[model samples]
Target: AHGVARPAAPLSTFLVGFAAARNGGTAADIEQACATATGLALEWAKTHPTETR
Candidate 1:
């Protein structure tokens, strides 16, 4: 979300936690959620790239 919006960082983290909690809040759940979020973010960054300024 670098080229997107400043609020996306916190919002994305909140969403990852929310997803983990909804799935049971176990270690595995948290890991899965983080991995999923990170993977998506990476893919998005690939297409979006970082902001110039």
Candidate 2:
């Protein structure tokens, strides 16, 4: 398995996406990451921006 655990892969991917969004990465990258994490399309996230703390 090349020393990689399949179960952990999704977590890693989710982190990358969250980091990208938090860091204000390009709209496309942020959207893709959010979509992957929520299973909802990027368009949905766009309509529901997170409130700033």
Q: Whose TM-score is greatest here? A: 1
Worst 10 contiguous positions by lDDT, candidate 1: 1-10
Name model 2 segments beyond 4 Å from true. Answer: 27-53
Residue-level lDDT tens digits of model 1 in 1-53? 55557788899889999999999999999999999998987888789767675
lDDT of each: 0.88, 0.63
Model 2 per-residue lDDT tens digits across residues 1-53:
12344685678676967778777788887876766655543455477665556
Global Cα lDDT for candidate 2: 0.63
Instruction: Give the TM-scores of the predictions, in the order they appear.
Output: 0.79, 0.43
Residue 31, candidate 1: C-alpha displacement in angstroms: 0.4
By how many angstroms RMSD does model 2 differ from the true structure? 13.5
